[model samples]
Every structure is written in structure tokens, then in C-alpha cells.
Target chain A: MATTMITTLDRSSRAAARGLSDISIRNLFIIPTILFLIVFNIFPLIYSLGYSFTDFRASTSAAANFVGLQNYRDLLSDPYVWSNFAITAKYVIISVAGQLLVGFGVAMLLNRDIPLKGLLTTLLLLPMMLSMAVVGLFWKLLYDPSFGIINYALGLGTFEWLSNPKMALYAVALTDIWMWSPFVMLLSLAGLSAVPKHLYEAAAIDRAGPFYTFFRITLPLVAPILMIAVIFRTMEAFKTFDLAYILTSQPTAELISIRLYKMAFQEWQTGRSCALAYIVLIMVLAITNIYVKYLNKVKER
Target chain B: MRKTMTSLLAGIGLVLACGTSVYAQEKELTIFWAEWDPANYLQELGNEYEKETGVKITVETTPWPDFQTKAFTEFNAHGDAYDMVVGDSQWLGAGSTGGHYVDLTDFFNKHKVGEVMAPATVKYYAEYPGGSSKYWAIPLEGDAVGWSYRKDWFEDPKEKEAFKAKYGYDLDVPKDWKALRDIAEFFHRPDQKKYGIAIYTDNSYDAMAMGFENALFSFGGELGDYKTYKVDGFINSDKAIAALDAYKELYKFTPPGWAKSFFVEDNQAITENLAAMSMNYFAFFPSLINEASNPNAKNTGFFANPPGPNGDQFAALGGQGISIVSYSQKQEEATKFLEWFIKDETQKKWAALGGYTCSAAVLKSPEFQNATPYNKAFYETMFKVKDFWAVPEYAELLQQLNQRIYPYMIGGEGTAKETLDALAADWNATFKKYGRGQ
Candidate 1:
């Protein structure tokens, strides 16, 4: 009786597949997703690329005219744009360097057998989980000269952090490191925990120094994943906007993304801002490509 | 047959009644504005409107930092999230040019919105395109940058004698810009944790520009030709340079950490008694004047902006106007709401609730001038206040002003003349992009 039932079910399934071919079934399942991506993602990118060549302002009803790369030329030639780029690069270097040092160091400390490891990791990860705007705002209050806890604890006696143009960019970078170091630590922890125990045993037996052992064994194994973290963070820092915008308005702190935002939304120079965005995208992609190539090289070794 | 006809008439009457009830239920409105003291009062006034007319009012507000971005985002999308908006005065230029606001010229005139409000408010907050007679908004609130000071300290005999001995004059409300600086310098004692003044230094928006304009107008300098949009000679004139220098000099006397201060910081400087005087918008004075909120409310007094060397005085305008959004589907209802809002009785209630109404009757009345300590100063400043360029290119102009002035004011980057020359060049370039100048 069971055999008869199994045969009957198999016959019904075969009957259902009789009309539709495998290719048709696959298309039925995949067409909607492909259409969604093309419509929402690709279309806007192409449309904006078209606008980058025009003199269109989103704020006005004036008709767009084909300026034929005038926006790109103007952006490239502008000294102010270059300054914004330089500021962003400085911010990325400081913020990413701080994150790498703090995050890797924390991961190394946590790699040992420890109590409350899950809870400890969760507490450290809280900063990265909160909204960027919220974090920026809280840090702003923390950096306030008159009432902030930072001044109170350090006994700096009304020392200016965000208000000082020379220090404002670094102040924001410090906050960025505070907020994002946990992200790197989480990734680094995953890589740290995966290393074989026998290597450490061998290094211990050989009396290899901590630094030498790290440089030779642990680093080689973790370098590929670490590169992945660096690539993601570098790209993100290049596109930083809300945190910098909320924390400081000093021209010294203005990143390229903030400049792009001012042009697109504040000044309503839609076409020019689009051109600026393309420039940033190309730069980020180029840098990311280099990092990815190095990451594959490490993986091969 | 007669019974059937009677029943049919009864059914039709019931259907009509149901439709009327549904219409009343749908009479809802939303007005977008910056989150501030006035927005709270506006909500209270809106509650009264709802009570009287059965039309529910929803007041949506965002923080001042992102208010402009929020409004522009909605306008760019042409969304109907708000039926009306209490937008900044300078926004009239962009709103009308971009067709974001309804053409309210006929309604404004028909309702006599101009005749009922102060003349300056009507001109600055309502009209666009200079003398073209186009109106986009109704003057909802009136404000200006005015001075607030420690009245108790000024009245003290010891302080008076000390100030007089040092400045060689009576220690009283400043009569001119020189006296103002003198008073600031007198009160400046950083060792005691007591500073002289709190002024706008924030580079985020128009804070620094507005603070500097007070000196510029009084010093007999202009931003440029308001009619023809010229900037080179006027903006970088010797007098303009003097005004820029004067503002920078005042920044020296403020508390050490006020380099990025604005209205909120200025208010804190006063309430915390950290400064002897501060500059802030009159719209924010209600909190400073309310005894419940501020411990030194009674001791804090208001004063008009001081005159310059030539005895010329003008305050920077800080107000907004109400307009029906063009994308709203409830235009007629929103129009009805405005007609009711600008009435004498409603405006009186608005002022009583701490909402600064532009109604001449409400502002000039003895009860209003004497209502709060700051009310009288607000009334006086409204008449003499000067507004920035309310042209279609205001955003670009402000962005450039912030960049040029911030470095010099905060970072102490260059000489005053050099900074002004760079600002003039920036303005010229912006205007040139708009096909206005060579």
C-alpha cells in the first residue's frame, strides 16, 4: 500500500512538471529579481550619469542644457573641491589607523580563554550597532565645552575640541574610531579564533617571541580577512557624511561627501554634484580594486 | 404613490447628512516648521483652531540643523506630507521661483494680509521678485537679532562705577557699537569664569553672517547692490572691512569655548550667567524671559542693536512666513485655515501663547509691549531690521558667505580686507553662474 502511494505521488509530481520546461521554470523564478535590480539600481545610475553632463538644478524648473562635461571640468579644476578631498583623505587615514590599532589589539586580548566572553563582545559591539546620527549627536554633547563630561573628566578647563578648526577634524576622527573600532574587532575576532592551536604550540616550544610569532604565523593567516575589513572601512570612511556633518561645521572638517551633499541638496547644483559623486565613486572603486588584488594574493599564499 | 415619494425624500436627506459628516472628519491639516519655542506655541494655537472649527491641525517639526534640508527634500519630491509650511523668509525666493509654494498674491491681497501686518514683515517675508507684486507667503512670525544683558549687574552701583571709571561713560545700555565693545571688555574676566558676551560664531548656516550684518548695516556698508546684484566694491569697501574687524574683535571677549556657538549657546551663556551679554533671535526670548525656565529671568533684560560710528543701527531679520504648499491636495482647506489664523482675535491668542505674530494690532498694543521684557525690544527691532538677499540664489550666496567668513572669524586666517575681497569674489562668481554679472 505504501509503495502504491509513493508511486502515485511521484506520478503527480511528474504530471505537474509536464507543461513547463526547466528553463522556463528558472526564468519564472529569477525574472522578477533581475527586473527589480535593473529598474531600481541600474536605471538611477544611468539617469544620473546622463544628468552629470547637463546644467540641471533640482531646485528650479529651468530646462537642463547639455554642458558636455563642464560640471566635471569645473569640479576637477576647483581648488575648494581638492581641499575637501584632502581633508577626507586625512580623516580616513587617522580614523582607519586608529581603528586598526585599537580593533586588532582588542581582538588579540580577547583571543585567550576568558570569562563572560559573549557578554564582553556584545558590550563592545554596542557602539557599532547604534544609529550613526545618534552616535554623532551624543558625541557632540560629549564634546561640548561648557557641559561635556570629557572636559569635566580631563580637567581641561573649557578646552575646545570641535570648535577649534585645527582640532575639529581630529575630534570627529576620534569619535569615528570610538564608534567603528568594534566593527573591525568583530571581524578580526572571527579570523583570530579560526587559527590552528598547533602553530601556537610550535611557536611556544621554539621560544618564538610574541612579536615574531605574530608577524610570521597569526598575521599571515589573518591578513586576507583583515584586508577585507580595511577595504570596507576605507570605502565607508571615503563616503562619510552624517557623522562629520553633525559633529562639526568647520571647513577644516568638511569631507568630500559633505561637499557633495552641500552641492546637491543645499546649493541645489544637481548636475555638478552628480559629477562629483562619479569622481568619488571612481576613486573608491580604484582603491578598492587595489585592496582586493592584495587580498587575493594573501589568500593564495 | 404619495407614501413612496415621501420615503424617497427622507432617504435623500439622510444621505446628504452622512456626506456632510464625512467632509468634517476629513478637514485635517499639517504645517511643517523648525522645532523651537514658537513651534510649541503654534501647536497650542492650532489646538484652539481645532476646538473652534473642528478641523484637526497637525504641526510637524524637525530640528533647526536639518529643517532646511527636510523642507527641500519634501519640496524636491513634491510630496504632500505637509499641507502648509512656516518656511524661512529667504525661502520665498526659491519657493516661488521653483513653484513649490502656491501663488497666494490674490489671496494675500484679498485678505489684506499685507495691510494687517507690519510693512517690513510684508515686504521681507511675503513679497518676492522685488517690485513685481508677487506674494507667496503670509507673514506668520516677526523676529530680529537683539541684545540680552544682565540688568541686575548693570543696575548695581559697584559695577556701574567700575564700568564708568574704565569706559569714561555711564554704565548702561549701549548706545553705539563702541560702547557695546567697551561693556564687553569691561565684563571680560576669564579668570573668574565670567566672560563678556555670547555671539553667533556657528558656521553651519547663516549664524555668523547674521551676526556680522548687524555691524555692516550700522557701519554704512552694503552687501551689494540689492537691485543689480553687484558685490565687488560694496562688499569689500573700507567700511565693510571695519565692520568685519569689529565683529572679530568682539569674538575675543567671549568665553574661550564659544567658537562654534549659536542661538542655543547664546541662551546657555545667559542662563548659566557665564556672559554679561549675548546676541540671539527675539523669537527665542520667551524661554529666557519665563521665570519657570530661567532662574535669572527677571534680571535678564532686552535692548536694541547698538548704532555704529555714524549713528546708523539695523538688526538682522530672523523670521518666517506661512505658505500653502503647491503639492497639497487640500489647498482650499489650508486657505480657510490661514484666513482664520490671521484674524485679530486669533493673532491675539497666538501672541498670548508666545507665538510672535506679525499682526500690527497685536504687536503695537500696550498689553503686548508690556507682556514680557523682550516683547518691547522685538517691536522696536522689527521696524529697523534689514534682511539678506532674498533672491533665487540665496542658498549659494549663504554657502559662500559661511566659507569665507568662518575661516577668518574662527581660524583667524587672513586680514579683514583680504577676507572681504575673497567674499566679494565668491559672491561675484555665484552671481555670474546665474547670468547676473561679469
Candidate 2:
């Protein structure tokens, strides 16, 4: 009886109630989160942003004087900085691509009916769960030219894995691949499992071979999820630090993140390092945007 | 919108609150030190300082390997996490560039700390580059490599007679590189649980660098000329190559797992009666006096590093120096702490606590010299000390030397000539970069 009385109310009263609700300050639950972000994250970011515009040497008071764009100008000219960025790019591109290929391959293999499937899946993910520093240091000891188990087993007559400039970056990359490939494999496996069986049945009725069926039916269905995996892995690869920094020697297979750390923390040129960090952030975002757009287009099709 | 404004105001309020707290403190100071055992002694000493002066002092320390990296990071960041740091003498060149340390020469002179430093130590360890008369750090510890021997083994009449029969000399600790090797070989009795000598090589390259540098220094071959890039004379010289060769010969007399030894490991071997003789820093003598630290090691003895053909015995004088952080707000308080730190009474207390002999006043004081069982030996060892090259590029130079030369020299992976030539070339290039070459 009460509900019917409210329904019997005029449209003007309902409109007044809707307007009041829309403008109510009680609806602002998100304000606290916003303020928390501004204080904890955004403020420091803005301060760092301001620093990027100055020279801002931390160690010496004489070098602490502001010299606008000089840090950036020096960074742009430094070959070592560019080399490190190139190394980082190589690491990201190679690791992401390799992860996708290997992950997709593993996904396809694991998607089938197999023995002890759950156990195998759990065992494979063990590497990914371990700390990156531990992984790096573990690999470093393993690669020790003298006492390492790797050399002892392979009988490879003293390869300076971490010490040598030629092998150090790849040595770090090998450890990364060992750790994260399983993560991508799990993602792709989930994507593969979600594909409807009816699509495969339809292809089978049409006398399509396994390869053709996979390309025409399965890839199209899983492409969106695979793209998601790529996006996540690419961003992670860009920010990779602990492994390379710990496992490998400096300035040899130097990556952008490590360079940023060294510049900001070691060189004490915070402004320049901040600028470089922002550059990395921008690049990663740009790549992510493009990848996401492509995934949306695939979905639309 | 009102809520958003209110929260933003709250953030501003928090910032102001923190800012006010920072402003309230008139001064703050942080002291950076290494994880050596003595740092704990210094921490106890810091309490005395705080009680005397109202200023608070905080200490931050890292292991020897990471200490420089940590200090360098804070300095590079202009982060005032430490108001002062105790740095290795070898790192002063690199630390000088970071520019956080205050030039204490004038302050030291005015306070008479410079005048009080031992003459031999000041001429080498405390003197800054370029004769600038500016001291960046005050000497905190002085360490030099010396030989430790088992006197009982040599004193055995039968063994002494056997030694004279084989080597045409008394069976005493050898006084030269070749003689040391010969004695080591003579003493090696694998069936009787004895090895002639021990050199620790656990962190293979690092251990080798220490041994190699000692040999090079003893043979009168410098790593590089600090002022110029003309490093060819001593680096790849006949003397340097001969020293490397002698190290190789000494290796044959060492026991199994010899490659995995360091200073403490080799010292442990001697103390445990596993080896006849060991070469290590002078600082390890105090451990021998304590039976608790080593039950088997008894009646341990010390000697100067063996001389070369030129009769000049030399060893790397590894020490640390303390300096005030230039950015510290409490310079006056920190300096006052340092002034108290260098006092004879204060120095004696520190040295007595099994710390390195840092100040000459304490080292020369009869009370300190005769206070401990090993005090006489350490004081005697101090007379035969030299220092390592203390240039800014010393880090990079050491890396190059250790990586390319050490493996070949000690690992027997490369010939003496090949190792020396490569090291010389690297040294020449490095010296040129530092404006220390022709």
C-alpha cells in the first residue's frame, strides 16, 4: 500500500528527488581515494616532475644549482645512455616476443588432455613466484665461471657469464625467460580453454585439417586474450630492474631502468633521471595504447 | 565538489604538518660506517659523544663491498641520510668527486689532529692528492698485510737440521718471495696433516687481487703513475711478471680447496695448526690472543712482510677515514664529536676494544702498546706499512686489474707476460683518462 502511494506521486516530485541525488555530496565516495592518491602518489610525482626541469645534483652543493634543460641536453648526447636504452628495448622486445611464442606454444600443448596436468601447471609456475632478486642472484652463482654448477655440468671450460661484457646481458635475459615464460603460458592456456568446442566441431565437419582449423577458428577467438598477455608482459619487461642489476655487471648490458636508477641514485642527477623515467613511462604507455587498440579492432571484427 | 576540496585541503594540511616537524629540528646528522667489527665499538663511543654534547648522532653502516655503493648513492642523490661517513682510504678519490665530504685540513690543523698523526702515516695515508693540504677524512683504522708463523715448527731442532740440509739455511720463516715458497714446499707433509702455506682465494678474483697487489708492491712495481698515463714502466715490468711467477710456484705447495680461501680462512688454517705460515692483515693478531675464537690456534706469532731482492718489504696499508658531510646542518656539533674522537684517552679506549690502530698517539702510548697480548706484534707490524693507490679511478683500475690479470696470474689461466701486458695496456688507457700519464 505504501509503494503504490509513492508510485501515485506526480512526475515533478520524482524529478526533484533524482536531481537531489545527483548533486548529493554523499555520492562522493571516490573523493577519499582521489585525495589519497594525490597525497601519496601524485604529489611526489609532481615534485619529481619539477625536478626534471633543473640540474639538481644531490651530492655537491656547487653542482646542486639549477641549470635548465642542461641535464636533458647532456642525457640526449650521452652515448652510454642511448646504448642502455637500446639494450632495454632489445630486452623488452625480445623477451615479450619470446614469451608470447613460447607461452602460446605451451598453452597449446597444455590445452590438450594430459596426465598430471594440474601438478605440471603448479610446478611450472614455481619460477614466476620466486623473488626476482633471488632469481637473479641464483643465476649469478650458477653462472660463476669457476665454481658454478652450470660450468661443472656443461664442461664448458670457464665461460665468464656475468663478468664478460659479451655474455652478461643475455645471461640476465635467460634468467628472465626462465622465470616469466610460465606466466604467459598460463594466460594463453586460459584463453585457449575458453574457446567454444562447437567452433572446432564445425571445422571438423567441414573437413578442415588441424592447422587450418587453428588459424581460422582458434586464433581469432584467442587473439584478444593473447593481446592482453602481450600488453601485461611488455609493460613488465620495460620496468625490469632487479634481475639485470643484480645478475649482471653494470654499464655492460645496462638497461634503461638500471640507468635511471644509477643516474638518479648513483650519479645523483635526480632531475635528469626523472626525465628519463618519464620518457620510459611515456613509451610504455604509448605501446600499451596501440596494443589495446589493436585488440579492440580484432574484437570489433 | 565540496568533499574533493576538503580532502585536498587535508593533504595540504598533512604536508604542512610534516614540513613544520622538519623545520622544528635545528640540525640533523647521520654517520655512515662499514660493517667491520669496530663499527660497534664506534657506536658505543657515539654514546659518550652524545652525553658530552647535546646533539643526537645516528650511525648507518654497510658491508665493505656495498659501503661505497651506498655512500655514493646517498651522495649522488644529495640525500642527507648521513652527516658523516667512514670511508676506505682507496675510495677518497671517488668520494672526493661526489663532493659531500668537507675539507678538514684547516680544521684538522687548527685542532692539532694533523700534527698528532704519525709522521710515516701522514706522509702516505692521510695526505690528499695534489698537495692541496686539504684532508677529506681523518684516519680511523690502519691495516697492513704481514706474515704469521708457527714458531714451534721452526724451533724443533731436528726440523731445523733438516731445513739446513735441504736449503743451506736455518729453518726459519722465509724473508723473501722465493724463500717463502721454498719453505712452504719443504714443510708440505700431506701424510702428516700439514701444508707448507695457505693463501685464501674464496672470492677468487678479490682474494687474488689482494695477494697480487701485495706481490706487485713488494717487487717495487706500481699499478700506475697517479699524475700521468705512462703506466708501462712498472705494470708489465720484469719485476711484476717475476712476482706473478712466484705466486704460481707458491700455489703448488697449497692444500686442496686452496682456491676457496681468504684472509680469515688462511688465518684460521694457521691458527688451527693446518698450515705452517699465513699472510694476512695485521688486524687478525688480536683474534689469536683469544683461545675462545680459536681453540687449536695457540702461541701465534707475527713478522713483517718478506722483503724482495731490493731488501725493501712492502704491504698494502688498508685503512678507513672519517669525514663530515658538507650538507649536514650540525657541522659544529659533528666536528666537536670528531675533536673528542681524536683525543688520546678516546683513541686508547677504541684501540683497546680490539679496533684497528688508527691514531698514532694511541699506537705510541706505552699503556696501549703493552696492554694486550698481541699489541706489541701489531705495533711492530705498523712500522713496515705502505698504502695502496688512492686515486678516484682506483675502483675502475682495480676492476680492470682484477678481472683481466688476476685470473691469469693466480688461476694459471694465462702466462705471466700475457697477463702483465694486458694489465699494462689497460692501465695506460685508464691513466690517460685520469690525466695521470705522459
Maximum-lDDT candidate: 1
* DockQ of every candidate: 0.55, 0.13
Candidate 2 lDDT tens digits, B293-360: 76644666666677776776777665677888777767787787788888887787778676775677
lDDT of 2 by residue, A125-202 (tens): 899999998998788779866468988899975566765556667777778888888989998888899999998998
Assign candidate 2 its CAPRI class. incorrect
Question: DockQ score for model 1, please?
Answer: 0.55
Q: lDDT of all the models against the reference?
A: 0.90, 0.72
Which of the numbered candidates is closest to the native, going by highest TM-score?
Answer: 1
Clashing pairs in 1: none
